[model samples]
Target: MTNILHITASIRGDESVSTGLGTALVEKLAAQSDAQVAKRDLDAETLPFVTAERFAANSAAAADRTPEQADLAAIADTLIAELQAAETLVISTPVYNFGPPASLKAWADLVARVGTTFKYTDTGPVGLLEGKKAYITAASGGTPVGSDMDFMSSWLRFFLGFLGIADVEVIAADGIMGADGEAKIKAAHQEVAKIAA
Candidate 1:
């Protein structure tokens, strides 16, 4: 059976548009494939930020590592294991300040380890993780399509591609502000149906 990891990054819980859409997509994906889904609510169960010590530990040779370094390395190993175990990933992200939340970035920092998820090569950087597909539900306020506004999709695509997850599908919900909020949400749901189909 296929293993799918669903990560919800919004802190808004039931009221989150990104979460709602992501949940719906997960249901659709489940119906279409015989997949076992694992959910990680990052907002509720936040991941610890990487520290300088953790960085040092990550770069150390296995035999030359101290006890503390070993512990940190073990944590990183666990994170990598969780990612590697999945055949697919679904991320629910709310755009904050025209980008993803700091918490989401922290999760990325932990998982996007050099020599683990990716490596620097002579050609540039090559992804280590392979054979994974990702779906990103991105929501933003005050920034719809065709507007001279900043969006996080570009950065997200770059980072995910660097990690070797080349097949990413994005469902974006934008312009959730002021008088157009309700309309925009309805439109976003319509878009979701199309993408999910």
Candidate 2:
């Protein structure tokens, strides 16, 4: 069965428009493909930000790490393993200060390990997670997706590319707090249905 890793980063919980839209799309995909989904709610299950100790642990050999470093390494290993096992990734995020949430960034920091998710080469950094598809559900209050003021989409796209997930699609629910917010959301729902189908 197809394994889908769904990561939600909305601190708003049940009231988050992005979470609602993304979850609906994932449900549709699951029903159509019989995919098994593993969810990681960043708001609910808060992940510790990457620290200097964690960095040191990542730099050392697996067998040579200190006790604290080993603990940090194991957490990173588990997160990386989840990504390695999944065929598709569904990221639900809301734009905060024109960027992604801090929790999502922390997750990225943890999973992005040297010689694990990526590696250095003579040319440049090479990403290891290849042949995986990713879908992003981004919600914003005023800033629109792909606009000059919006850093969320481009940042995410670049980060995902850095990890070798080149086949990425973004389904944005933008301008959600604007005058035509309801219409925008309705249109986004229609688009989500089309994409999910």
The regions of model 1 sitting more than 4 angstroms off are 61-64, 145-148
Q: Write the per-residue lDDT of candidate 2 for residues 1-197, one digit (tens) a residue.
A: 89999899999998888888889988998898899999889888788887787878866778898888888788777878889999989999999999999999988888888888889999999999999999998899998898989998899999999998999998988988988998988888899999987
TM-score for all models, in order of appearance: 0.89, 0.96
Q: Give all candidates' CA lDDT scores.
A: 0.81, 0.89
Q: State the TM-score for model 2.
A: 0.96
Best by lDDT: 2
Candidate 1 lDDT over residue span 97-126, tens digit each:
877787788778878878779999999999
Off by over 4 Å in 2: none
